[model samples]
Target: MMNYHKRFHARMLFALATMAFPAMASAQDIAATTAPASQPQPGDENLVYEIAEVAGIVKVASIGMDPIKDAAAWRQVVPGESLGRGQQIRTTFRSKLKLVARPADPPTVILLENSSRMTIEDLAIRNGAAVSRLGLGYGAIRAGVAEGGVRSDMQIATPRAVLSKRGTDIFRVEYMNGRFNMSLSEQGRGLLQAIQLQLSNRGDVIGMKSRFVTPGQQVTHRMAQAIESMTFDRDININDIFGLVGNDKLFTMLNDRGFGFLLPFNGASNNIFNGQGITQGEDGVAPFNNGLFNTQSQGVRSITDGNFGVGQGSLPNLFDIFRNRDTQPAGSKKSMNEAMRSIFKPKARPRLNIGRVRR
Candidate 1:
């Protein structure tokens, strides 16, 4: 007679089923008058970590600033949920998350994506090592550090930058599309695995130019019109840009309209970054046209991502992507990031000063 509602939902199926962060059932309520604070009261012993892996759409709020009055105050961290220390994990619009701070030996994985917001400021065990300290606060994270025999002190803090465990294996921080992402790779010869990001913005730590990132390899940062020196595009070789989009037909019409992650077998080689080939305005060097692998020099322009526009005469134009499939945006993810932000959005030339015309 022990079925306790299917054993309490098999202990809440241990978090990570996937897809379900589309909360907008109309938000208009916020009058709790400082009353909601107990996202962990059902025997929460500050357990630390245990939501192993989740895919798409997630929510958990043990807020740190206090002020909740809607979205039923977010509460769903199935999968043996046990977290601790002011939790706050979120992922909406094509969600993906994985948190396994420690299952045994040397495991520490916390990969989140899609409109993210992470927090777990400190998980202890210090003096004996294992001192994770996260706080992304915005979006994008990928910290997978295994090779442990014991002794780990992971740390990621970003308002601008601060990622620790410097010997490096894998640790990421992102809040891009606005730029300021940065990769720290000194490894990789012929990538089949990629996670290269380099975006930039400056404010603190002397507006960070480069603050020692080389534990494993994969960094991204640039913006503020690219100040330059992220190691000159880290040797620019994503399989030489997928050997220059090998299988043509406009690369299968942009891999049948997902723009095959913009290029390269389309997975940053395979470390799974997805896409990014931007370089715009004011001589946005190599905005996919540094002789784009010279595709037979049969010129014909019009490549846009500044907001949408594509032309590649003599071939590409592939019927202009059905001219607007009835105002897209279904299944959200802003219609796959507006076709991955106009397939690597970067169409420059807007750096004006009104200078010379000296004939």
Candidate 2:
């Protein structure tokens, strides 16, 4: 006999999953609201291109009115060299903290070291008091206080920034020594991974989360890994590291983090975009009848659609190898973009023959 009860439940669950499509659409709208307005238009259905790419004619839009342009002069936002006096400003990445789990009983601690001599107050993470009267570092205290929680040392400070979590799952954020810390167990790590994927969109750090964890086990492990991975002994050139592309704010972040820019494609040598200012094919100028920055009539696809498949048929297609080699590649041979091309593309060259060749 068929199990009618189980079959009925299975049908009910399938119906529920089908009904969840509307919720998925709403979540996409939320993601769109969080995206920067300066992102480009790619005329594809429900697909927004990243900041760097441009159609044959690039569309330019400012996220917020440029303060310098709005005020008719450069306004002083921050004052000093090291994150100047009025340096604190709102950014896309909010510096807020969220509390995930708290034991029914919270612990406390006391302060140990405060450097009074410096222009800015220097508080050691280890030098804090504790309710259990246990040892807690300055990092732990900073992390706790920043998250608006009590450190192991009993020190408490509220975080200035706020982070938005998509799910009910929560975690802790702390600052120690000079580093930021995040703690998540297996489930917590899954939530953290979701957050990180939304933030950076890279899956390199996948499989790093866990279900079971102590207070600081996962955070401490990640922190140690970050420190050990640094190659401080090797010298790096500041300018060489930060390639010139994207917005100035992204540039600033890259510089602050000691990273340089690298475009996904060697756009510099790609003659596909040549003739940007040509009367005819004679001088290699493109007769641009279209406006460069038309968002409304030819705007980017919104995230409202569940289809986030951008690179498939959504983006503007670059010319094929044969076409590019005969026409576009001609102008790219002696260009300074050779290094860029080689770096952006490290695969073996596509074999081409003068006559017909076997595939």
Candidate 3:
């Protein structure tokens, strides 16, 4: 039965690929083959953050070292210890971390919810003010700026979202498994634009594409200029787009993998968003606006009275997984696996659609 399902999924994906963006797929292949390798990243200057507080099981490791499961790596951190550039910070199940960005004008505070990972990308500080950028590899992070915290320059980029603010504001970005060059994403608060870059297997850019998204919009990524998907995506009226968009690579990938990737692009009939239109956690906490764990489970669902195995009838289906993810206790390890993994490997080439996009 399991094997039958797998074959069915593969066939469905192949059919969609052919029916959707046959032309773009071919172009993507050519672009990928002809693209150059990514250039080496230069070593950045040293910048640092301090651990303001920690909840259950937060782990800190350097980008330069192997996984630190030994007591030493876990014990090395004290509240004032410096977290330099190129380091990774993670929180285990039921854990939260508060980090203070060093030397900032209005001061900056970063909160990492459970099952999240972040990397320090760049930091430039002078005269008690700092410009620090961090990449949210996956999971959720909320950045806080002081009142009047608007910095014309602060930027946050995620696999699916790029957020910037003209004034001091609080924002959150969750990365649920996307592999793409983030540098091409623009920086700003109003109507963030997307730059779709087609990359070679070696991670070099060969071609590019784009779109415009309103505040609170989510965009997924794919390789090449699969004009097929990009084009049809734009035809949906902007207002209707929210209700009808987003049946791209992520949807296929999740449906196949059984993590319940079929989301309500048809609008918010799903209970995930509440009557007031604010996202609610299992605890029924509405609006992840303020707190360490506000959006911790953003891409996950809760599993109540069931489990999400390939068959064991544990989870029964995807929606059940969503239930577990939303209601599960914070830092619950079992619930963690119920989240999305960045699974769009282009070699097998999930079918893509590039519809003609009209502004």
Candidate 4:
């Protein structure tokens, strides 16, 4: 009986050892894997993008030189965190993320809506021009390039097509399943070009096709199909793109963060009324559209009369408000540029009424 009990005990010990071997091996394997890549150091030349804002659940993964062996795990992103090339970002449902490409003179602002995934394939200053390349795995993103002297080379690659832009522009790209769509906002100053690659069954590139999409236009493509172009419907506003309803906090946050320029206004003129009922041109439109006022009327006119609104000069210009810093609220010590920059700085930012709408 003693011998039999000893044999049984030995058998149980062997079974337990066998069961723990795989777990030990897995632990060692995990330890052998590379650790998460560290955040880019300040003033790093490769540091081209920064997280300006984050809402809801958003995470980022840093892909190392050997993506397979050294890919970093995803972690929550914080505002003002800088990202270099090979950084990938994703958002969960009802989440949003804002990124700024600092290489550009005026900086390019990119908003990634909910359920989106994107990778910063490349971002560098090439020959004094900001060159950016992005890969969209799925979902949607809106990008606005501020007007500047140097033309920027920005390209977004989707599964169906590649959208390229030179210079300042505002555009949105969405990719889902096998469908791809790119739309240029009516306020954009530059054109967007789409390139579609024709590949063989083995994924060998055989030929390529291209199309130029102008402001207020859109291009779309499906799986292995020809690209189609159409006019972008003006009814779709920023609120619609972000799937927000009345008085959404995200909308208010965007305005406070200096991204109010992206919000579309009704009618042809990009004007917003101040509290005093005075119409003011949006700051973004004033710099690119030649002047603070849009002479074009929304109503159809049979006769071409440039003298419609003669007294419109009385209306305040958006830039004028910023240029005249004396008009700022009392006790504000920061300049207009400093105030704008403070919006991105967590410690220096001031709390503003988010419910207030601004164009």
lDDT of 1 at 42: 40
Which lDDT values do the candidates have, in the order given? 0.48, 0.27, 0.49, 0.61
TM-score for each prediction? 0.22, 0.17, 0.41, 0.48
Which stretch of 10 consecutive residues in model 1 shows the poorest summed lDDT?
24-33
Model 3, 27-104: lDDT tens digits are 222222222211123453334677888888777775434354454554335566678655677777898888876655
Candidate 1 steric clashes: 37
Candidate 2: tens digits of C-alpha lDDT, residues 1-359: 34565555544543453355432212222223333321322331121111221112111222333434543332222211121111111112212111111221222111112210001111112222112111112223212222223332121121211122222123444444534444543443222311111111321211121122233344433433444466465645443211222243235434654423322123343233332332231123222212332222553322323334331333322333334445544557644354345445777867766778877
Name the lDDT value of residue 354 in candidate 1: 80
Q: Provide the clash count, candidate 4.
A: 0
- Order of all candidates by lDDT, from best down to worst? 4, 3, 1, 2
lDDT of 3 at 87: 65
**lDDT by residue for model 1 over 35-81, one digit each (tens)?**
12223334322336777767666888766533256567676677657
Off by over 4 Å in 3: 1-47, 68-82, 126-129, 146-152, 155-168, 179-197, 208-214, 222-359
List CA RMSD, all candidates.
25.7, 29.4, 26.5, 30.2
Q: By descending TM-score, how would the candidates be arranged?
A: 4, 3, 1, 2
Steric clash pairs (candidate 4): none
Sliding window of 10 residues with minimal summed lDDT for model 4? 25-34
